[model samples]
Target chain A: MPVANMLIERRTFAKERGTDLIQSDEESPALTQEFMVANRMGIHARVAAQIVKVASRFNAEVCIAKSDVAANAKSILDVMSLFCPYGSKVFVSARGPDATEALSALAALFQTKFGEP
Target chain B: MINDRSSLTIRGIGAAPGIAIGKAFLLERGQIPVPRYRLFGEQSVAEECKRFEAAVKEAEADLETIKKSIRSEFSDHARLLEVQQMILRDPSIYDESLRYIREERTNAQLAVIKALRKAKELFSGLSNDEYAKSRIADVDAVGDRVVRILAGQSRSDLDHLREGAVIIAHDLSPADAIQLQAGRTLGIVTEIGGSFSHTSIVARSLGIPAVTGAEHAARLIAENDFIIVDGRTGVIIINPGETELEFYANRQDEIQTYLKQISRHSHLPAQTSDGHRVGAEANIEAIEEIVAAKDNGAEGIGLYRTEFFFMNRVELPDEESLYRDYHDLAELMAPSPVTIRTLDLGADKLTSWCPTLEEPNPALGLRSIRLCLHYKEIFKTQLRAMLRASAVAGNIRLMLPLISGMGEIFEARKIFREIQAELTKKRIPFDKNMPFGAMIELPSAVAMADLIAQEVDFFSIGTNDLIQYSIGIDRSNEHVAYLYEPLHPGVLRFIKQTVDAAHDAGIPVAVCGEMAGEPLYVPILLGLKINSFSMNPVALPRVKNLIRRSSMKECCRFVEKVLRMRTASEIEEAVSKMVMKKFPEEFHVFDPNWIGNTPLAAKKKSGS
Candidate 1:
């Protein structure tokens, strides 16, 4: 098969998987979670760095969205630019080969408050 | 922009001093290129990803090298590089670009460009916020580095800049400012910066001509344009005519001549014309500044802030470590008494080991001696170290910072006596009669100066905090900074009362604030009988020259005249006139237009 045709097929599969994950009736490849930004300084430089460090380890496309603004979780600048002040709820979504692993790691990081008060 | 090349002159804050006439070297703000291209197939997509990875690696390596080189000398800048490195390693940038290549059929460079633009857009929405704006600069810096690597461009090395080039830039980071070669760089004109910016501070230290807050200097002054930077008057004349060049040339020569005259008295005693003596001292933070203090003819070290030992350490400094540092300083400054102020940590500065209390207003909360008194063991450890150091070098005096009333001084005195007794019991040969002093910084201290003076040997007026507290203005707050006038009537009265009370109690008073160094305030302080003036090392020579030229009798009369003034402006007008009249040569060096003031020129209007 041509690469473009294969990409189209994969996109369709990913879309169907995303829908299934939202329905919660079938096994899905994607993981979605919400967390409060517990760190007093929120997603500042150091905390954003930590989030990116964890998200990059897995073969997952992670997206962290605060309000209507979403950023690539692996990009420190993107995560920091979200401007998720302390106590704001951050929505995390992962879709790829290792979406579950990426989601769990990120959730753990948020729970630890990025090792800050 | 002022495009009239022949006679255009711009004004800005004179951040640093010295004259420079040189060709302009306009630094273009580094704008990263965002190249977008569609990938042909899977092979092309993989190739683009590889290119992106290589660029990221190269950028990371470059930042690491820069960080390592500046680690020792410029640690703060090195730390900034650490954050940038983290940004480069961020997987989101890599993943986002990889996804773009796989799904969108775009090249790696385009993907990275798209990701950064998303970040930039987020920051742009927060343009009104200063914190967010600074963060935007950081984001741009990271993006620029990556883009430069992808474009196969090397970092712009300011180190090898051509000699005698005036640096014109939109803004310079602290790292860039530090990298500026003092000899090669003739002058600096920035589009956006302040007098207190890191760039300005570095320029001042290097004694280079600098003018910051020049709104569009980089755009107005083209590369290689003939420009004359007048640092004294904060003026920049571009493509000067022959007549203007000649005028500046003569003015530059005059300033140099005046500076040479001031340095000639570096080794002279600080005495008035009528032979009344006053001690000129230096306020130092580290031992390295001791030589500068001595070279500037400081009679003694009036304020040796001991917080240096406590900062940047994992644990509280041990007695041995503190003792060695203090002993060396005391011994080097021999016979010249070193007034070592106890640990003044808190308010703005805090230690990791110390218990952190959340204070809404840290400035008014537990700080300085208050923090020390609460943490008695820390205070005792420091006192033990100072006393031990003084044992070997007997010219050490203890000065307490942020004292509110007589009770704190009394408690401190009690602890001092106890420490002396403990040392004596252990057969330690420390100076038992080491003079103790209180910093009259708070209104309470000034109000109860007589009682406080009776307990301590001398008084050192910390006019920086005193003025801030009296005027109800935080000096750091730019909005209220204008109200932080040291010449205000209430402030002067507080100072006068403190000086008189100290004198009445048979003790001397010294001023170790920004006001003490200002030549404009010297005569008034002299009239108030301030026994000593402790200031920055650079201001010493000029201040000493002023003191030596003016008589005590004349200073008293000037002070009396100033004290009777109603407003701050009136007092300032009267003092500026008095300074020009008494020391016209020195006044010209400080401000050439001082004599042009109508109030100063009209001598017959109010003949005192």
Candidate 2:
């Protein structure tokens, strides 16, 4: 798939999942997605804070994992500890009601290179 | 380490020239202790997490305050603080510590340490790469701040340092070095750093005695220990004996008297004894330096470097901003011509928006006028701004830097005309005959000065680059730096040729380089009929004193004799002898050996 089309499909899927989350009251479903670190600086402290800020906006437990070490996405130290260099892929997952919304926001942030040139 | 109880002396590189004696104030980087403990209950874990969050909040607030205070003086350091604040609020750190407290039942302090250690390890793994490794220091700084806040320890504040105190540090970052108050801090001795480090530069500009690369400076010098820092000799004497103290006290008195004598001529005009008037101007980079230049009795602003406006900025400054800056400068130095040099960025100084291409020899690559020509819009905006500024305030001249040939001059003039025509159509009031000048920096420019002078209204010989290019020695390179001689016979010939060409073309020439500031070269430059001198503000009074005391006839005679010398050493010897004979007091303060060559010694030899 073209990268732009894949991004559009991902957004639509996230919106549908968010609607489903509103419909259900208890036992929120977990959502997971993998993304490549696109920024050349590779998610240093500043970029990590940016990701955490986006994740904190949603009422969900966002966690980022590289191999076996899973770090809370809402924590900058944890995201930075992931040591995700450029071209490296990490799995981003969220639990609770706003899981889909949180995952979608994070994926968009990564794709945009965190607004850096 | 040297014993603190006994007298000891250490040697380092003398970065600045002065002598200072004061009590040592040890400035050690604060370290935080992290102790491990277990949380027995849910309430304890929650309480520990709350404490950790509060500390992080305090650290973030502290960094914000620092950023605000430093923004005006040190913009680059303020940017670094922004990164630090982000690190402080990183969720990865907060969440990992929270998890450790909740899952492993550990205390908040221990959990925070573990999380920070993980990040540190990741950063250290990229130790071989300088960029990646530098990021580790930022991480550590943020981490250390949080830990210190938790421990209730205060940050190291160099801004409010006590007067007459000697600062002894392991190493000083540029931000910390800039924070050292000028009058309060007497001297600086660091354990690590070369003579050309940022800290040394700041110390020199502040006129403070500084010694760097002193082994164990922070460890050996205890707090409140009496220390003497001799910046000229790069010596640090601790717990000095009475005799040593007396000797340095006399030397300090001599330096003060010498400085006072030179400062007496600050308000005097630079004129030869034969009544030949010369202009002594200043080369300034920032707007704040204009007041200093005026205070130092500058006849006018000779070289206003425009690169400072482009540096440490995200985008290029627009026409209005550039115009306002130039207009303000011209108004401040009213009635005196302010020669503003267009953007001389690239070589050693690079901008983010317009990055120079990567090359092995950046010094000789596309830079200055070459780079400006490549980016026409950038060049046009600047010319338009300068013209607009000239409309608001008269006495503004445009100078082109690093022009190698007439081709660059013709191209620049074409753009200037276009801008002038557009501004003219708009009915803006500007000096239609605003003078344009070129800097003769390259050997090619010197060789073709006569041809280039015909096109420009004036010429300024930038000896710093001219000597480097002529000698094929980069002055910054330590191995070949010794070969960078300004008094070489070839360099003199170039200056003589360029000055003659500028005069022949009915235009004046000015030396706005390091050579103009040196007292030893004053007579030689005057002999070449180069009257105008532009240099650092601090050197104005002394150079003016030298020019004011000598006659043009005698200077010309001395230059004629020295030009006949074959080697730099021979020329230097003759100049030194002449200077010692004429200005014995000034020469004696700078060089003790000149004392033996005084007229007294000559009279004694005649009697013998």
Candidate 3:
């Protein structure tokens, strides 16, 4: 039931971010998954640093995309530029041997809201 | 120099009322100038980048040192400092500075400024939200640190403050405010903030004289300059002559002596002449206050404001922390009933979690029980903890604040039942028969009092918010503060109605606001038949003394007459005349001046 509601919310919000997406020019696309920013403060600087910290742990080259802006998940500044406000959605894509692990780790961060209220 | 210097007074809002004559410790944070100088050569440009990098690292180390040294109670401040450190290292500012240095050929200081400006552009581009603006401010704060470091300056540490230092600062964050040592920080004067700000709350809690909103305090008051802070009236007299010092010193002595004299008899039971009695309890947040409360003859904790456990942090306190706090408080109070009010954080206190709920008018916004119900998970976690803690001390009683109507009471009762069932199934022992109550601080609650009284175990009146909301004026507003009269006709009528409703339903009522404490208002409350008085510990003795001296017959007569009166001034005049006429010696000794709020105003902000 919760998932169904989230699905509708995702669609309603994506209608806005959909206008900003640009297709990647790579020959084959990286594995991608979408996550919602749940914390009240959204993907702020400190949360961005947590993503960079997690992303840098693996060999995967990860990027977080929101509103037409794709940021290198290893760069705090780059991740902060994406600016995922609370309740917004972001797509995480990665390419490497540990791409699956990288996506899951970022997923967990978003799930816990980087351990914030 | 002392002889030549004339006394100059700087006026600001009095956050805490007291008198402090001490030397100044100017905590001029983030006030350094950014010096712009051109790099002479490639060698100098490279050196400037290294300089900026080293300063950034040093600032990081400095913040880490402070964070490590910070006690666990200030975990919120530590988290905030950690974010600042991350901002210091972010490529948006760090790498951007290096990029600007190499590309724009600007000096490192100028490069740092440009980098920060670039970061600001990126943040503002995301959205013109308050969150983005705060992020920009964080960047600016980090930029200031690097600039100050580059210019060969050091950060002022509040932890190492000298004794008798009255801290004069731009402002202290809530965490910094909590870090102030009572003996070390004789007083606090900030350039910004009102009585409700964290600095004021902490200053009042620590019993330090504090004055905020002094615009020229930092610029005018020099380090080690002798200053007298009259926290009662928000006056700071700098370079005072002998006569001025003598007068302030005498006033200080008189206040101390009067308080000491009254507190000597504070432990006496609050039983009126005609054998009428009411519980004299104390309102407190920290567990450290159990001793003070006990010393002042507080029968039990009247209002254990649980918001302190949740405030000043990026994360909500887990069930474990909340449980431990409630359990410890329950154990300390033992057989005495401790009423724990659920989260009553208005927008101002819930800053960390309610970034999105920044209502234009927060007082009328979703708060207290409303905020709890909206954040169900948060509320549930607290309820679970409170129930678990109740298992340990059986004396814990649950109370809801700002309960506007019957719907909220029913809603909270439902939550309580769910938690109880969960506890029962889990075999977690708790006080199943624990008393539940509602705080009667709103007119709607008063109107629905008889219904609410039947539903709850008791009623506690928060007269601070009751007066504010009842009068349709913010007491914090200087223009309307005078109208914050507990004796106001409508407020008095509301109190009378609530007490009547509770008695009709065979339940007790406690008044736990400023009105519950003041001697001037004791007769009025006792006359209204309030079952208990819970207020600041210092106010307990005098309030109890007045209650002990007066009879229910006289009080009832006064109330009957005051009820017929039309204006607050008339009611106030009659009460003052009767109380003063009866207890002239006690009145003369304490001199509470009977009019202004005095030191009693320094208690923590209203929990509405």
Best by DockQ: 3
TM-score of each: 0.60, 0.65, 0.66
Model 2's chain A TM-score stands at 0.74
lDDT of 1 by residue, A1-117 (tens): 332333344445335322111212245544668889876556776677778878889877787766545676766666776777667787787877688888999999999988864
Query: Model 1, residue B404: displacement in angstroms?
Result: 1.3
Report the Cα lDDT for residue B251, model 3.
72
Of candidate 1 chain B, the 10-residue stretch with the lowest lDDT total is: B596-605
Indicate the residue-level lDDT of A114 in model 1.
86
lDDT of 2 by residue, B1-608 (tens): 22234777787777766788888887766455667888888788789889988988887887676566552545545666776676666544666677788999887777877777766655554323433445666676667677766777653446435466989999886546755666778899998887656687667666788999999988889988999897766788889767567767777778778878788778888999899888899888766667668767889988998987776544566776677788889888888989999888774455455655677898898789998898888889999888888875578989999989999999999999988999899987778888999999999999899999999999998999999999999977979886788888889989999998999999999999888977778899999889599987767887898899989999889888878889887887887888888988777765554322222212322343
Give a tens-digit lDDT track for model 1, residues B100-219: 778998877678777666556556765235447666667666777677677775434354364679888888875468656667788999888776566776676566889888888887
In Å, residue B338's CA in model 1 sits off its true spot by: 2.2
Q: After superposition, which runs of candidate 3 have C-alpha atoms over 4 Å from their true positions?
A: A1-31, A36-49, A58-60, A77-88, A95-117, B1-5, B8-11, B25-31, B155-164, B169-184, B202-208, B214-225, B243-457, B465-501, B517-529, B534-608
lDDT of each: 0.76, 0.76, 0.79
Q: In terms of DockQ, which candidate is stronger, 1 or 2?
A: 2
Best by lDDT: 3
- DockQ score of each predicted structure, in the order shown: 0.17, 0.19, 0.21
Runs of candidate 2 with Cα error greater than 4 angstroms are A1-117, B1-17, B21-30, B36-156, B168-178, B189-205, B210-251, B312-314, B347-358, B593-608
State the DockQ, from 0 to 1, for candidate 3.
Answer: 0.21
Tens-digit lDDT track for model 3 on A1-117?
233343344345434322122233365346778888877667766677788889889887787766555666776656766667667788777777788898899899989978974
